[model samples]
Target: MFNWKRSSVIISASVFLLTACGGGGSSSSDTNNNPTPDAELTAQQQALTDIANAVIPVLQNSNNQALSLANAIDAYCDEVAISSANVASTLATAQSTWQAAMTAWQQAEVMNFGPSFDGGNNSIRERIYSWPAKSSCFVDGALVDYDDDTAGFDINSQTPRRIGLDALEYLLYSNDLDHTCSTDSSTTSPTNGAWNIRTDADRSLARCEYAKIVANDVAAQITALLDDWQGAGDNYFQQLSTAGSTSSRYSSATEALNEISDALFYLDTEVKDMKIAEPAGISADCASTSCPETVESTYANQSLANIKANLQGFLAVLNNGMDDLLEDAGQGNIASTMTTDINAAIANIDNFGTTLVASVTGINEADCTNSTSDNRLEEACALHADVKKVTDVLKTDFVTALTLAIPQSAEGDND
Candidate 1:
């Protein structure tokens, strides 16, 4: 069911560069006086064809590790039935990555497009286009759900972020449609860049818009699964109080909780991998190879490394936030009764959130362009932390609030 969307993730990446509603963008990187260029969307389609050809061979090839990942996803799906609470957690992961990527891309895309300029995504695209190796954690889908006025997906819908990622994929891999400027021999050409800095800023703004949706709509979809976990937890306790007797019901609840954790991991992985990987895995820091003057020590000493590590530690906190998931699902043991795994996980993440905000708040924006590898890394790290803040809310803080409203079940059932 998700194949169509997944396949398209790398295909639709071209259109995001365009401005709709029949308006032309200036900031034209081209020197041409022409008001409009030939429709180059076709060139974008061709780019997708090229990426498909390149990636498909690998998909069909004989490889152990690559094949193993496919097998694992299959096994995970079978355990949770395609429609249970497990799907909630499954969507959660994708939702988080999508939220982060959109923020990053938009932060990069947020510039205004003026007339007389092609104003393509030159500033950000060029830097990332030739990059090799993708960091799966950085992949993100750009589609907006629920809160978005652009595309309003139903609360129960599970289209996945593949389509959104596809849009970005096309942009990254597609061949250039306007190399006319490159061939021109003018030494003082203003349109020599692939895309403009304004466009990059727009990309980042669009991302922020998408993050708002994940925070609201995506969270709603996961509520039911969380409800199931809490219900099952309560039921397990009630039964034990009546008698130390054990039953198969608790095991079923255990399975449901496990499924929830696994599903979240899967969806998040899907969104995170597809986009982040495309730009060649993101680094800790690099500011156009120009390390800042103040950063005189080790490469890792740059604020970017600290930012990257903290952001990574924050992601670690989210993954680790669910460590207590299975604990409450198990058979009634003494340790189980005394602990609220979900609560503890939430607390840990909340604590980390505070630290991230502190590290990010004080850094100067000028440090973003230093000569050291750490400068760029630091910029990405700080930006990453911003995304992480939103993620913490969607994945942890929001979940914590639900415990207050959801009535813990006194009896457990799979439904």
Candidate 2:
């Protein structure tokens, strides 16, 4: 289950967007093909609809980007790579490139990392460590140890070690932190020697957990921003609902929006700083020739896992916290300014489905705890275009829309 609070931000905003259209009418842009009703809505409807107009597109792009990136990684993994060194090199390159991207992002912004940005210190254990022996993100009812396609065999079966490795490493933005697969089953259990590229003991699992620490911290940052906005929304609403004149709503909302704007900018800064990097010493061991690559990988996996656990824990907490907030809303604690129609818009976000997230299960491969940097270098690439997309939209388009929807009243007083 995705954290409801975080998820609700989208839903709440989205709901407002949906109902914000002109009173009785549909969008002015709808070529429709099928034109429906037409009439100006109340101030509230206009407001929500305006918000929706700006929000949904951002969500759609960001979510899809993440999914696309995951699928690409899975597709690459399905192709049996040329060799272990090749996989390692690929991992190293990707790791470096992605880190660069993160750095570039952070550098481009003015916010602090792991702090002002997104709770950069929160650790996410469950998010990163997945037991291939027991998990469920697969489409088929049950899954095999590495049987990515239980009933159907695709090109992915031939994937290289690196692709699987990267996916394992970056589970933070890719996998559904909530409702993680229920169990891990495979035709060839890695426990009984099926631990090669398709091992039941994947090392990157630990990396993912480690990354969760960063991701969770980032999520915290997101939640912080959301809270700030909600508070601002409340203030703005208070003025609108009880003021003798329209001045209070305009003034309060303007100030609140300014705070929200800062939060959004900071969120961008935080995300940019989240660097998905390999630990200091990735592979330090490996004198034994008899040691299967899988065994070496397991050692590496464990090592990274230990380093990342603290952060992962916090990630889970962030998710839980947001989920709790959503639960509160479910139990009837929404704002009076919000309408049921708006709620439905928020619900629309749930409609955003995922395939890569559902089709794959955690793969068991190299171990992390005792593996070497040379060995632990295994990598996979997850494109967080979706999350990035939405984040970008929140930063850009939504701001513009909100400004227009909640324009300052001529009679309002700011002092």
Candidate 3:
């Protein structure tokens, strides 16, 4: 499982934008219907409520988008089975919807708690998109098993390595029927005699069928996640919003706040280090000075978009509720600085006209070291620096100001 560190929080500062009520008769400005609560709640309450209201809908959108992707896969599979001329267009539509679902999902990536982290394994979250745990060979084997209707071959029982968005990416985007496995004894090898003998049309049809199975599972996971948030029995929204209450899961409002802040570190470890530094050849993970192969969504070339979506999720938490908390703690200047720094990071990504993989490759390492502005490598490095600015404070003054602890997973690493 990927290190699920980053978390999202939203507490709209709009809560402070209430209509005035003075000793005078009602002015026309009194038209604002919803006023501030008569009894003031702590910042944690407001933040949790706002996050539940804002992010649950994003999760729902992802689920809806997954349904569309599944439908497209079904149509494409049918067309391929009959060798229809519309195969090309149908395949394009399936890829497009998959991209849409991914964008929404990336935006919700910061909400790394509650149902998504059920059983502390991130089972539901990984089922939707298991990155860093990706395995093309396993997906290839599972495809053969699913196509052959091999005994005990069930999509539900398969691990994250063999299904979800990453698996679907391999199926839909890869034209190579050749299996990625190295051994002849592997499931997709000649000895197995299942995958290698298939014609191009048969391979295409089989891949589509397997992709549809994964898509349905992804969609079902999304539904279960949303239900976990809003359902009457296991409602996380109520538990978070009513922190410290008799029936609430959290014993104190600060405890809930700390959980939300822990998630903000996603920018530090995942986006800054894994997404940018390693691919840009700045991290030890890359064998060379630059490794374009390390970039995410390589098949679809959507890595840049994924980073942008991550920043969007981070900003949703920072701007929505954390800003007000900062003001309440007399650290409003830090809030302003964090927002400005995060926006600068987003602006850096926005300037790139190409995918992250393209930006990371074909660069003179010397020019990047000198901070050349015209090349892709320099821009990618700048993005890492920009995000690091927010995270530097996140691990230091931000936590001090909010009285929140850095998550145990995030401790003891200079990078």
Candidate 4:
């Protein structure tokens, strides 16, 4: 999901104190001679604990869904390998399961701190869902190499670019043997050309085996992440919730808040810039009115779904985690406004066609580059603008009120 060190740049902390800290209403005890007040539990501290509590269940559910996705992928691969009679149904089921996993993953994206961060040289996040830098050539090469010597081809040995969600997407949505390694792309090296001459059955079986291997690897990684969070004793969740304690990673509740707040910038950068603007050709990299090839999930036609999932994830962070904090800060109205704006943005996308390619193609054919007329492109643009409004509030009002740090990559990126 996150490229870790590559995309992230270190930025100095910018903390703002906008409003006075508001106190939460305390409950009175019925029968107590002299009950000691929980004076140490401040509003900020409660808010941090609330966020941690809200997040734990979501993460556990996400882990279960990841396992389910792995099972589905493995089952689909097995059917494909044996040329089963129910291959079509199995593939469809696998696609559905993948979407479910993607939804859960998106929800967890806002919490992409702490355990999700890279440890030393290991990248658990990329091992699960490497995008933008995905290399289909690596997948193609792996398939070809597997065909040559199945015993020598190990999917786990492949780099992060070749064997995550994107690789699985390539294998599941695209036809068998469709990917090819070429010399033109610098992201991946060209492999042996032997696969080009292989029989259809051979290529399909090879791809299926590779997909199975990737699924197993993904499952193991996801389970490890889950275990780190709440599977047993000495979990990260306890450290996160018990901030300021000697055992906690964070020395203060604000540090925990900053981590979650910074993670929300994924919506501002990746969702807004890469997913929406890049494909719309509004990004700096594109000159045309639209670039369908840059769109994520182009093969599956699930770009809109991805956007919806992202917004939903953002909403989850606000409602489940940040609402109480905003209320304590006497800025509950901001949360209400954000909820309304985000829901409206989602509805705008729903009004537009879900298939991004089809919508963009229609806009291109009409040559409605600058037209203000009520058309698909205009609708899409309106949705983009609406989402930008939400982002603006998040970066400015939300972060400033919460005194949260903006991610370095997202800093100064007004787009």
TM-scores for candidates 1 onward, in order: 0.21, 0.25, 0.86, 0.82
Error of 4 at 184 (Å): 11
Q: lDDT (0-100) at residue 110 of candidate 3?
A: 76
Best by TM-score: 3
In model 2, what is the error at residue 299, expressed in angstroms? Answer: 15
Output the lDDT of residue 96, model 2.
42
What lDDT tens digits, residue by residue, belong to model 4 across residues 1-415?
Answer: 1101111112112221111111222212212323233423244455555555545555656667667877887787788778899788988988887777766666666667778775623577777777777878877766566656667767667778778777878887787465556652332224434565656776677777777777777777777886777656767766775766644588876788788888788888888788877777667776777777888885677788778777876776676547666665557778888877887777777777557666654455233344222343455555566777788899899988777878898888876
What alpha-carbon RMSD in Å does predicted model 1 have with respect to the real structure? 26.5
lDDT of 3 by residue, 145-215 (tens): 78777455677788888998889888889878777888634565333375767677777787788888888
Candidates sorted by TM-score, best first: 3, 4, 2, 1
Candidate 3 Cα misplacement greater than 4 A, ranges: 1-41, 150-152, 188-192, 372-377
Q: Which residue pairs collide, candidate 4?
A: none
**lDDT, model 3:** 0.73
Clashes of each: 71, 90, 4, 0
Q: What stretches of model 2 exceed 4 Å from their correct place?
A: 1-41, 71-80, 92-149, 152-415
Residues 191-280 of candidate 2 have per-residue lDDT tens digits of 433222333224333323223222333333333433432345553223322223353433343343343245334323222112111111
Q: Candidate 4's error at 214, in angstroms?
A: 1.0
- Please list the C-alpha lDDT of all candidates, in the order they appear: 0.27, 0.28, 0.73, 0.67
- Candidate order by decreasing lDDT: 3, 4, 2, 1
